[model samples]
Target chain A: MAKSTITFEDINVTVTVPAGTRVIEVSEKVGSGITYGCREGDCGTCIMKVTSGWNHLTEPSVLEDKILRENMAGKHNRLACQAQVLGGEISVHPV
Target chain B: MNKLELHDSDGKPKAVMLSERVHWVGSLDPDLRTFDIILKSANGTTYNAYVIRGSEGVAVVDTVKEGFADDFFSRLESVADYSEIKVIVLNHLEPDHTGALPELMKRAPQAQLYISQKAQSMLKALLKQDEMSYTPVLTGDRVSLGDRTLEFLHTPYLHWPDTQCTYLAEENILFSGDVFGCHYCDNRLFNDHVGDFRFSFEYYYAHIMRPFKDYVMRALDLIEPLPVTMIAPTHGPILRDRPDRYVRRYRQLSSPSLASEISCDQKTLLIFYISSYGNTRRMAEAVYAGAMQVPDVRVSLYDLEGGEVDPFVDLIEEADGLIFGTPTINGDAVKPIWDLLSSLTVINIKTKLGGVFGSYGWTGEGVPLVEDRLRGLKMRVPIPGLRVKLIPTDEEIQACHDFGLELAKELMGLRSQKVLNFADLA
Candidate 1:
């Protein structure tokens, strides 16, 4: 399985995991930041700004997109629980 | 059966029977310290799923949180097989109630999902399954299952937009999703047998249901006529004894008593103002003096320059009328005034009287902009906005006073005549 690198820019921490790992799982494993509520995309608590390598993440699901739009998030923002890594380096920051 | 026998003789938790055909197939999380990262659940909580067995098939109303899937499935299997589930009712699309849905749908692939009409897109998004088939239900929609019937009441925004209530006709039970639910978890399945949960009940309503009080009232109106003997909500103890008391409490909490208080001949008028250079402050004082001339109208003035808008929200919601005074900076109203206007979204101010008075240099657009926002919120702007140049002259100050007086008179007339239009009564 291919590996993906995730950089939490705000905390200056980086982690490596399998390509298909959800960003929420990485945050939980790190346990430093990014508070969560509902884990599903219904709540916008886990919204993160994709600072770099945005194409390395999966497309936002309908729920994630709706919630992100509701929160007035920009195109670079994605829900940590809804977007999975696609085998590349992705840098993000919690909004 | 006695309440103490919630567990088997071996002391393991078992499914409790609500009626001959309705079983409480839910999971209890007694160690849960918090919910949704906001509410503190010291008494823990329960994900109350119910199983209804008809002569022909079975239906499941709601499911537990994702972590409790094993317990939920064990309890569910104790009453009915996974293949027997013909219907799955999603009372609310929030994850606490629908977290186990993916696994449940996989096991009970034959079950058809039913939700409120507003919940279609939400269901698709939450389940991440756009192709999932579901029956959209309205207020009076009903689905028959042999000898029993499941009726849906479209009660949206009890806390979420996808919320609805399911009533079981044969058992006289209301599967109220989160309406009368609490976060207190206990082994006692029924409210009659549980300890005092008054704090938990009120805490749940204050934290979850308070923001949508108008919807709570609307939801109450929809369920008022039902002969509901039991209220099985998606959380906490089942209200099997005098469930109407909970409904009455909701009604009392949601109903604003300010209107009735005005009927006793005392009405409140709030004047909020933010003045940059004492020009708008003079105009606000004139407006306050003018409003003070009206009989039985209590006027309170607040300067918004350095004050927070939150403390005045309840007062603003209860006031009979409101006047906003602002000093135009550049081409718009001051930020404090805009902040005050934005805070109105959380409260119900639909038909209240509103007026705007401001002092601006050249544009004088601040007063009209504030008036437009008040009108956009569905408030009644009986009089046009009052605007004066940089500082008000004596005559303009009197005009500001008269603006306040006329608006107060309009409010009094509306209250007295009970008419939507002031001109109609005049």
Candidate 2:
């Protein structure tokens, strides 16, 4: 599987995350300026918008579907803690 | 019909946008007089649905009834597109909240449904959507929608087994389902905007939330640690400015120690009496007057002659002392007094002071029998059966009053000595 390049546009940072890696973990490795709470998706602290490549992220879990359904506005947003990289490149923007 | 026609002619929304990301997309039934053929809603009601817009997804917290589908969906559309909505959370799966679910599902077909683990079968059965897919969330479960996370807190028996509350972490908003809801419809949308809703709020509490006081306390304890800035209940005005005020009020209402007047420096005495020919009633009146002599004691008198036993049973659970009066007939207490005493034995009445008095035409076995029942229930009988032959004279009535004072003294003595004991140990 190819590594997915995730860019944290707000912090002007980018990181190569392997497929199936959570965006939150990748952000932590690259030292992105994203805040988080209750990393299990209970807290929407690490919510981020995907500027591009929304489908590159893995399908949200039952919990993530609810959080996104409740707080997010568009299809291009995902919780960094719960959203895993599937393939291709993705851009992350702090909401 | 004209008013309704004019209202529909105007394409404006009755809903209010509460914040940058939150919209109060609920419907108001201003003429609804009753709820579920019970629970009087004099001020009508509101079925609240909220639209929360996160950076990447749009979610609807709950939906209104089917009759108000146009109003609910229009209000929802005023904020966001239905097709764009990705998820719908049913904090409570009651029909009033989910009446529009079928229609909502049809319109927002892309949206996934979320309900509590316990509500899965019920929701499916209720909607008859056995094949529908839904995510069953637990207490600490979390869902993320871009830059926002919504946490579900399982607070069962806020009147239902499958009830839960949604917590928006970034906004510090608690969509508290039915836990803090009242059947009030207001366009104002918030506690600060609405003036003095305390009466209806408490009324709603007593009717809907009172039976679940234990769960109320538990739910309060669960959310105590969260930085809750707003309480957006599925009904009535949302608590945004002072959410803690409602939470604290609920805490005071549900605390077992604060259930009645006994929590203060006062004790409550409940007197149950049956007077066949005004004799036992007179003795009960004397007991009531005598008990009132104590500065910090509350007394409630119930006539067993014509009333039901259930409410008095609730009073029995709260009172610090029990006093029974009966007119002895055929060597036993009147049937009503016996009925009251029998019900007392079935109840787990706590240790408290007990007093019994009676008016006897012949053999006065009734007073002793009442006393025996009290003793059987583990009550401390300070004043033994005060048996009087027929109606009591003025002097005997005074003695009956003294019997009441004895009970008050015993209660005061019990409380004061306990305090002293605790102080000494400390």
Give the Å error, residue A72, model 2: 34
Predicted candidate 2 versus true structure: per-residue lDDT over A1-95, tens digit per residue? 66777776533455665688788776654434455679898877677778898999888788887777555335677888988888787887655
Clashing pairs in 1: none
Best by lDDT: 1
lDDT of each: 0.84, 0.77
Cα lDDT of candidate 1 equals 0.84
**Deviating ranges (above 4 Å) for candidate 1:** A1-95, B1-13, B29-44, B210-218, B264-268, B273-282, B293-298, B302-312, B325-346, B355-396, B406-426
Alpha-carbon deviation at B279 in model 2, angstroms: 8.3
TM-score of 2: 0.56
Which structure among the candidates has the greatest TM-score? 1
TM-scores for all candidates: the values are 0.65, 0.56
Judge the docking of candidate 1 as incorrect, acceptable, medium or high: incorrect
Compared with the true structure, what per-residue lDDT tens digits does model 1 show for residues B254-356?
Answer: 8887776556687889999988889999999999999989898888899986678777887887787889999888899888888888877656776677889
- Over 4 Å off in model 2, which ranges? A1-95, B1-10, B257-271, B278-426
lDDT of 2 by residue, B1-426 (tens): 112211234766645666788878888887888886547777788889998888888999988877887888888877788767888999998888999998999898898898987787678668987689889998899887798888999888787777999999999999999878887766566777665677778878876777667778888888888999999998888898879888998998776652443557878888889887898788889988988888877888888867887667667756788898987888887787666666653234635667889899888998887766665455556455798999799988998898887777777763222111111221
lDDT of 2 at A29: 45
